[model samples]
Target: MVKERNKSFIFYFFVALTFMMTSLFPSSGYAAESNILDLEAKSAILVDAKTGLILYEKDAETALPTASMTKMMSEYLVLEAINNGKISWDQETGISEYVYKISQNRSLSNVPLRSDYQYNVKELYESMAIYSANGSTIALAELIAGSETNFVKMMNEKAAELGLENYKFVNSTGLNNQDLYGNHPDGTGAEEENLMSAKDTAKLAFHLLNDYPEVLDTASIPKSVFRDGTDDRTEMPNWNWMLPTLSFAYEGVDGLKTGTTDLAGYCFTGTAEKNGVRLITVVMKTNNYQERFGNTKKLLDYGFSNYEMQEIVPEGFQVKEQETLPVVKGKDKEVEIESTNAISILMKRGEKELYQPVVTIDEKLLTTEGALTAPVEKGTKVGTLTIEYTGENTLKFLTEKGDDLIKSDVVTTSNIEKSNWFVLFMQAIGGFFADIWTNAADGIKGLF
Candidate 1:
């Protein structure tokens, strides 16, 4: 009876323990805590520029019209051409009928390019970015790739190269057309043309700011005016309002693109840096200017107020010191390994030093059997060195660390192929006499 009572007590204890464990874990539908947005934007994303961490996102991947923000990619390609020497900043482009007709329409932004007039690439790019001029965009596109049709092909290819799978480009200028739109009267283009997502726009912005920071020279400008090189100075006003309206604008909020269309509403891709932390926020498809500015400001305020950029890995931070890794059946017995780079982790201020960093390396990658041959480069990526921490997500790439591995030539000292009969005989006789002489000396020392 006592044994039965003990077993029943154990069963009750286990039941209580199970209840505690279940209660300790969060529910399956528990959401990550985030600030709620006031204005309704179809899509939005906030990302850490340094670490590429998505801090907050709402419908970021949903495809929508990007409006004049498409020119961001256009601007990137044009800048690349200038950098590559395929075109020059001062290179002149003939004003075509396409450019002339667009200038006559007030609805379109133009620099008043006459049919006989020639405008330099610099004026065209400035006009396109500052005023969102459709004429300059088309003229610049034609000059770069010989025609806008061919330029669109390059745009698609470049988008593919940048891993923007969900994006498609129909025209350099994101002008809406009814024929292109399906039966939906919402004015948004069909899914097949002139569409992109907030995430991809952020990705493009990241690459542009990182790869070609000079593009901001045009995007951040308050206003610009240019003549069509025919004596008539046409004034083009910048549509980006953030430069004029905000007094406490973050210092690094210099060079990002803004866009708007009847169908896609208004969109802004803005970046700001405070202290050392840089953040990029994308607000898309807002109803009006106030909504765009308010939503973007809210996103930026949330980022600057909450998150920070912390250098988890300092400049000299190393996972492993230079050590020899063994090699088998090769010219070398061991190879030298060193840390490839110093990685930085962007997180909140206090959160940086709180988490434990776990270092991991692949054993197979470290091994240098037949995989690694002699004369490996100094900075070749031999193996991945990962630093991780515990958080809302499992572990992310602080940076993709790799081995600064170089091959060794330590096996040459073990050569055993040489054979000489005379030398061997002389060595044997010398060894015997030497052993006898050593024994005699030892015996004399013993007697002493």
Candidate 2:
């Protein structure tokens, strides 16, 4: 007996270890087994833009200088202003004397900013986002917020509103203004620069893509000439080499920003769509420009090939699959349940056994005798069914209740006739406490 017990213990221990180790290290074969993944970057993350799901990551929360990535936020704010009708695409804004001088700085990337020649809001925005033109960005900031300093404040405020904790913005252009040669273009000294982790950067990009898809419309244009149809028209090629114009472009690769600074190294926050799936990859501080794009391609390939979105609950679809539960009193003897929302989940390539739901019906849905009571109505929310993702694909969703636990409503599919005795005697008993139970449950739910 003792020898048999020892063997059982050892076998269970190995099973537990396998689960743990496989989960920690993601394997190319199966993601459900967490095999420790590696990436060549200071920090990196791959996420589902729609669900805000982190597909894979490394030091994803470590803040670092973002360089031109700051323009993403600046661009978002400008478009937000346009979306809100505060500004129009054709509205012409004058180039500040400060912006004009900064544009002349050969050290920074810029478009030709002439004080005498005004550019439309749309042209200037494209110049700022596509070329990372500092002058165009500063002009947009000043036009939107009255000063670059105020614009930076708005940037930080927007970051906070988005629940991003790992971000700091001292300038809208993501450049070290004060440390760079001297005072800022707007004369407000810049210092300390800006920083954001891979996770926060992904979130920022997600919002940019979701809230203002027009950003992609601008980003997708591989090359556009500013002040077009005019002599001063300057052609600008998007710095994001992943675009089709660049040989390194990936299929379905489109709009997004890239960043490079002495401190930031080569960084890119890239997005692509294949078949209806879109993914966001933020690779920061890679050794070189090529590596940034190369690693992003690898991440995108892994994501697109290894996972897919599965619709678990189609809205308004009848859910009558689960076995019916017993009902005691009332008109019916059992009930089945269903979900209303079109719930979807991101799952691995071929792992179907990752989630097993443990149906938990509310006690109230059962009778006083602890049996499911009848007189149940179809489509009525009887209780909640909880599906706990387990084993290989154990993703967690932290809530006050539990992590990675999903719940859906359970309802009656059909009615069952109640016993005459139960109907007669139980009605009296139910009348005595039904209101009390209703009040108590409602109060408890209210407290929650």
Candidate 3:
């Protein structure tokens, strides 16, 4: 009786331990609590361009005027049309009356455009990017989408596809004309301000950089000639003061756009690369043009100083650190698994070491759990690995106290060939006995 009572107690104890383990370390892994940095701008955000991980954000969802920054989307659409073979760099677009009048407005930034001179896609794009020329921007928009109305529709569609939460474009120029709902002076395009949240703006910038990085080719030019070598030639200087050519330029800063409007105040989307790490910082509604640059510099300084991107699980990372798994029918009864893609995590400096890795096997890859069936091909994803940040404590494999930082797919390292009839028979026998033992063990435990 004492022996039976002891067995019951032992079974109950293990069951309790199993529940505790499941509760403490869930199969999905733990999500880490993030600490955000303080920012000064009315709407600002900093994100790791590659990882799409947001490092800092303040009122980033509130929509505000984006001003000439709206040109980014207009630029993206033109590039898309070029890439899809719908248009070429040499395609010409005539300047419309609306484009001409807007360009003539001394209040707005623009290049000297003539209604008689038709500009190529390349020259117009250059003028739009370098000079923030409203006429050049609308010209490109009209050329791509047949009309500014259709072009703005395409812009909003692309925004939706990119998961932008709050973005509304009333005109290609991003001008603030309270007469937006009413008829426009041209009797064609709506005269309203373009609205975008800082976070959405950052997201749009990422989409632009990731998909059409060539846009930077124009954004990075310190100085370039617009409609060069002609009677209408004009020299356009890069408005982005963060370029190294400028006295106040920050290190590694590169191509992006800037904006200033009465309603939006001042805004800038800037990118920089250092030591193989690239960061995207967006500042909206600053006091002035100079202050926008200052806010961007602060965000970039904080990002580069505090965070480091580290490759934790490299692509083809040998699973179990080179450990092999048993196979049911393969000629060799064991096979190896590896990571499918390289996995990196951006963390605060010196904080990466506190993380621990946990592999959640989709199949029972354990030797005792029975071998996986043969015919496993190389790169066959079979499981996932979760990395948990254990906070201040340095955790090796212990993760109960840690936060789940990143997850990566684990795959087969090599192919498992089919087995001969004899090997199959042997595997079948072993599986049968393993199943019997498991069933018996479960039955005994069930009594408790």
Candidate 4:
């Protein structure tokens, strides 16, 4: 009997312990997860290409080595130089000895360059953009700024102008300074590598696409021969395998840059457009070439499936209490106001109703009583109407200067002319008599 009781007690004790453990530490299936994505990368982000709205992010602000992806800034500067007329497509430039040595390394992504030969700006840029050629990148940097050191300065300055945060540019090429064969740009450490946050990477890509969309024309080329028909010609396959013609061809995917290094692992900045909605994604520090693209696919899939460009508030919308503003000493008592343009944002599915419109009138244009002065013209700029989202998972734009996102101009719908002096005098007289009658009526009621 005692043995039976002991066995029963032990079984009950074990059962109690199991229940306690289950309650204390819930399974992943029952736990509350903050991230919607299951990415296999150290850091990642998804952004709306048009609005710069960050749809999702995972440790996106932490700075990490960017590997060859640093070339995007170089590409931006090159495009800028071209557009500014500082350099033309057919402009010829000769390679420096440093660039020549880098080109012959063969181990690095490069095409053969001869010191005696002059290559046009277009061919060198194609080599850099499509193949991530370190030598060609430095050559373009030199062509624009006279030297790689001066070019590095230009890169950092442009980063600031573009609102890129948490970034450092040690070289025009993304290669580690050590790879520069003891000729690394002055004022930088020998072992230091280029660094940027995933958010900043997305921001850079954003400005690149928006500022110079023509970049896509070159970036989209999947395969081309550098110096084709020449003895030094070499095959240049785009590192971005997500191109429509590549092995990992994803629908609507094109025109991006990829990076790989010992510290950076595998990284990719990818963009895709489907149904007029373009999304840019960045994945950093993945295990291999495949993992970077795989993680990017997860981000893009989530964005394309869950979000869309939605016009939350129609154009010419009027706020309830702000429908009209009183005009002092005017022919009209009040002037109507409405939004000048439609307010649209990349919103998650079924969440459009959660956003509310907030209107702010310009205080300087109004009197102390919140009335506008007379002579308010039609289409006069009154103020601004902005949307405030009241839902979960609200992500901010990549830059703080994103006031234009989900915001619209509020202006007067009709003109208000000033009243004549005689009319104003008559209104004052009438108002005085109306006040007197009101006071008399109140006095009579009190007597009763």
What's the TM-score of each model vs. the native? 0.71, 0.77, 0.79, 0.91
Q: Which portions of model 4 show Cα errors greater than 4 Å?
A: 1-34, 440-448
- Give the 10-residue window scoring lowest on summed lDDT in candidate 1: 402-411
1-448 in candidate 1: lDDT tens per residue?
9999999999999999987654433221101323354447888888776655666677777878888888888998998999999999988889878667765565666567788878789988998888888778888888988776788888889988877767878777776644222221132344433778887888788778777878777787876677634466776666666664444344457657678877789888887777777777788899988777678777777677666555454332334443444443334545555444455555544565554433333444443443344434445444444445555554321112111111111211122222255655776788799999999999999998
CA deviation > 4 Å runs, candidate 2: 1-38, 179-189, 313-335, 358-387, 392-448
Best TM-score among the predictions, by candidate number: 4
lDDT digits (tens) for residues 306-402 of candidate 3? 6788877776666455456677667777777766666677766656566666676775544465567777787776777777666743222111112
| Poorest 10 consecutive residues by lDDT, candidate 2 | 396-405
Residue-level error in angstroms, candidate 3, position 296: 0.9
lDDT tens digits, residue span 44-85, model 4: 988889888887788888999999999999999999999999
Residue 13 Cα positional deviation in candidate 1, in Å, after optimal superposition: 42
Cα RMSD (angstroms) for every candidate in the order listed: 11.9, 10.2, 13.7, 6.7
How far off is residue 162 in model 3, in Å?
A: 1.2
lDDT of each: 0.66, 0.76, 0.76, 0.88
Model 2, C-alpha of 65: deviation from truth (Å): 0.5
Order of the predicted models by lDDT, top scorer first = 4, 2, 3, 1
Candidate 4 least-lDDT 10 residues: 25-34
Off by over 4 Å in 3: 1-38, 178-191, 229-231, 319-322, 364-370, 391-408, 426-448
lDDT for model 4, please: 0.88
